[model samples]
Target: MRDTYIIGVGMTKFGRAGDWTLIDVLEYAAARALEDAGLGENVESVFVANMGAGILNRLSGLGSAMVDRLCLFPAAAETVENGPASGGSAVKIGAMAVGSGAVDTALVVGGEVMRAVTGWEATDFVATLTHPEAEYIYGVTLPALAGMFARLYMDKYGVTPEHLAMVAIKNHENAMKNPDAHIQQTVTMEGLLHRPEAVVNNPYVAEPLRMFDCCPVSDGAAAVVLCSREVAERSGKPLVRIAGFGQATDTHAVHEREDPTELAAVRTAAERAFAMAGRKPADVDVAELHDAFTILEIAQSEEAGFFERGTGHIALEKGETRPGGRLPINVSGGLKARGHPVGATGVAQVVEIARHLRGEAGERQIEKPRVGFTCNFGGFGNNVVCFVLEREG
Candidate 1:
């Protein structure tokens, strides 16, 4: 495969994009990325990632719409949907197009306008990712599933509510530094767990997973410009390449997995990515884990090989996962604070790491990060995509 590098990255602030249509948000991010790349309307291919446009927005043909909006006439355009992992899948396709000599320049944009519906409606929309017969028909939602997973993990790993609170507090602090993050307010352990009014302030969403633990429903978009080595070198941007990527899937139903607590897809995907990148967890400078729920941060940290199994929360207790620590996970505040615009998230993860590698991340930047990793979890870990990105000089 030919070498591929990201030339530009852009994203809208993750929050309520009150008046913007889904196409509007997607166009905004795409324009910014193209402008950042200085590519004009030279894109040869376009990949738009969206999960709920058909269901939530009553719209379809996103890729064609984006091409028309961007005026990239005749560019190969397609929409990719893989539940919440749609962005990662789109990026993967874009990279493959460039890497396989199919296209020199590819544009990938992912966005979702979920808040247009009521909160409950949005929840039901997202719950459609679960198994239709075994999970969805039984009224299973992502938060409910995460709560059960958290309960099981806590019992097995000795992770207490305090650890979960720690994840929320830390990510909230990180989000404060990210202008694009959805929730700008900071959270405190006492306010979330210990205070008398904690119950009212941060009520339970699903058992063992409180309001603070879950990412807010948000509307946003993120985009990246990928190109071959020659194009990247000529563009005069820092060379941040897609070093390697891996994808894996487990059973559709959570209970069908041999070990429900073990995110086998996450483990396998990360392993394949790291092997392809010729690096290990210790070599990673910064990382992003899908933190739809706070416990997921702890669980993914372990599964991604950042910490030993069942020891991620212990590492969190040691301040190892925070900024300035050994490894800064989710310095962009993760989904917990960054806002999970489903389709936008995976691309947003890449955008964050690329900015860090380019030394462009503002207050939340890591110190000279060389290698970065991202884990985009889909369908309760049944489908997963992992990417290993590196800075080349």
Candidate 2:
């Protein structure tokens, strides 16, 4: 296979995009990425990662629509949906295309416009990701399932609500520095502990998880330009090589899993990625974990080998996952503070790591970063994808 590199990455500020349509967000990010890559007129093909355009915007064929809007009329285009992991999956496919000589350069875009509908409608739409008969039929939303997982994790690992709060506080602080982040306000322990009984007060969204613990319903898009090593070299920009990638899946229903607390898919994917990169967890200088909820960060950090099982909370307590700590995790604020716009989130994680490896993250930049890793989980860890990125010399 030929080597693949990310030449450019761009993303819209994620949040409630009041009036913008899904196609609008896609076009915005696609144009910015093409410009960043100095390939405004040379895109060969396009892969779009969109999960719920039809449900959210009453539109399909988003890939073709994006290509049209970008004025790449003749470019081949298709949409890829793999639950919330759609973004990372699209990037993986684009990288594969470039690496396998199917396409020299590909534009991969991940977008979702969720705010076009009411929050209840969006919530119901997202519920389709669960097992229809056994899960969703039983009123299991993402937060409810995640809360169940969090409860299990807490029971087994001795994690506390305060530990989860620390994760939120850290990410919100990090988001303050990221212009593209959705929720930028810094929350103190006291602020979270004390709020108006109506809004900011901790009312349980799902048992044991407050509204703040849940990722916001967001509408945004992110795009990345992938090219073969030859194309990257010609662009005259620092290269972020796709050193390793791994994807895995498990039972769709959460109850079918033998252990709810153990994300076996994440462990397997991370192991494969680390092996391909010929690097252990210690070799990673930074990371971006799918923190759809705060507990997920801790669970995934342990599963990815960054911290020992049941000790992820200890790592958080010591600030090992914060910027300027042992290993900075989620300097993009992760899905929690960064805003998980479904399909956009996974690819957005890749964008952040690419920027970090290129030393282009500005305020969130890690010191002398060399290797970076990203993990994107879908459907309560039913599907997991991990990538290891390295600076190409």
Candidate 3:
């Protein structure tokens, strides 16, 4: 297999695109990535990643639409959807295409226009990812799942509401430094947990989970240009190779698992990625964990082997997960603050890691990061994709 490199990355701000259609968002991000790669309509294939555009936005055939909109007339086009992990799955596909010599250059774009309907509508749309007869039929939303997982995880690990709040505070702080983050406002423990009006300011969404703990419903897009090593070298751009990737899946219903709190898929996927990259969690200079919920950051940290199981919350309290801290988990503000446009999220995580590796993360950048990693989780840990990226030394 050939080595695949992410030569360029681009994204639209993670917020409401009031008037832009989902395809419009894709076109914008795709154009920026293509231009960033210094390619003039040279893409050979296009992979569009999105979860709800078909039903939520009343749009489909996004890949062909993007290729035609960008005037890459003959480029092969395909659309990929794998629940919330859609973005990561698309990148994996594009990378594999380049890796197998099937495609020389590929553009992967992921976007979601969830705000097209009311908030409840969006929630229902995401709930469709659950088991049709077991979970979705009972109206189990994503936050509902996170709430239960948080309760079980906390009870077993001695984690508390304060620990979850710390995750929110840290990510909120990081979000402020990100120009494109959705929730740019800073969150204080007092406002979220201690204040007399805290209940009003941060209402409980699901039991033990407050408004601040969950990622906001957002609409945005992100894209990346992937090519073989030769194409990357020809682009005269900083080389951030897709060193390795792994994907895994668990039971469809969350309760079917032997251990509900253990994100087995996440752990297995990260291990596979690390083994392929010949690195360990400690070797990861920086990382982007899929933090659609605050507890997910803590949980995923452990699952990805960044911290021991049940000790992820301890790492959060000790500042090990904050920027400038030991590991610096979510410098792009994460899905919690960066916004989770489902399909756009996985691709966005990769784009964030690429920026840090390229030394273009501005104030949020890590100090000369050599190795970066991203974990894109889907369906309550039922599906997960992990990637290891290494800078050219």
Candidate 4:
């Protein structure tokens, strides 16, 4: 297989994309990526990643629409959907097209215009990812399930509300430096947990998981331009290779899993990615873990081998997960503050890592990061994708 490199990346501001159709947001991101690559109409394939355009926007045929909008005539076009992992899955498909020598370049774009629906409607749409008869029929939202998981995890590992709040505070602060982040405002521990008005200020979304602990329902888009080694060298951009990628899936029903607290899919996916890259967890300079919920960041960190089980919060307390810390995670503010647009999230994670590798992250940049990693969690951990990226000359 030929080597693949992500030579260009682009993202729209993550939040409510006012007056922009999903197609408009997607086109903007894809155009920026093409311009960033400076390859001008060399794209041979296009993949559009999205989850709710049909359900929420009453639209489909996104791939064809994007191609027509961009005027990339006759390029192979396809749409990919895999719950929230759609972006990652789409990237994998693009890499395959390049690596297998089928295409010299591929444009992969992911986007979601979730604000078109009401908050309750959006929440219900996401909840549809759960098992139909076993979970969804019973009205299980992601936060409700996360709350139960958080309670069990706290009982077993001594993780507290304070620790969860700490995650929020750190990510919120990081997002303040990211112009594209959705929640730029910072949060204080006192405001979230320690004060009398905390109850009103940070009300519970679900038991044990407050509003601050959850990622906002957002609308955004992100894109990446992937090319083979020869095309990459011609583009005159820093070579950020997709060294390795792995994906795994657990039982669709959360209750069917043997251990509720263990994110087995994350562990398996990360392990495969590291092994394929011929590297270990310790080699990762910066990482972007799916922080759709605050607890997910901690739990995924542990499962990804950055910290021991039940000790992720300890790492947080020691300031190890901050931008200049031992192993900075979520410098893009993660889904926590960067905003989780579902379809856009996985591609956005890759975009953040690539930007840092290229020395473009202004304020939250890690000093000369060499290897970056990303874990895009899907379906409440039922499906997960992990990627190991390395800078190459």
Who wins the lDDT comparison? 1
lDDT of 3 by residue, 1-393 (tens): 889999889999989989998988888888888888987447899999999987898888888899889889899999999999999999999999999999889999999999999999999999999999999988899999999998999999999999999988988899999998988988888889999999999999988899999999999999999998888888889999999999999999998999888899999999999998889999998999998889999999998999888899988889988787889999988999999999999999999999999999988989999999999999998999999999995
- Give the per-residue lDDT digits (tens) of candidate 4, residues 293-333: 89999999999999999999999999999998999999988
- Evaluate all candidate structures by whole-model CA lDDT and list the values in order: 0.94, 0.89, 0.92, 0.94
What is model 2's C-alpha RMSD?
A: 1.4
Error of 3 at 196 (Å): 1.3
Provide the lowest-lDDT 10-residue window in model 3: 33-42
lDDT of 1 by residue, 152-221 (tens): 9999999999999999899989999999999988888889999999999889999999999899999999
Q: How accurate is candidate 1 locally (lDDT)?
A: 0.94
TM-score of candidate 2 versus the correct structure, residues matched by position: 0.97
TM-score computed on alpha carbons, candidate 1: 0.99
lDDT of 2 by residue, 327-382 (tens): 89999988988899998988899999989988899888898798999998988888
Q: What TM-score, over all chains together, does every model reach?
A: 0.99, 0.97, 0.99, 0.99
Residue 66, model 4: Cα distance from true site in angstroms: 0.5
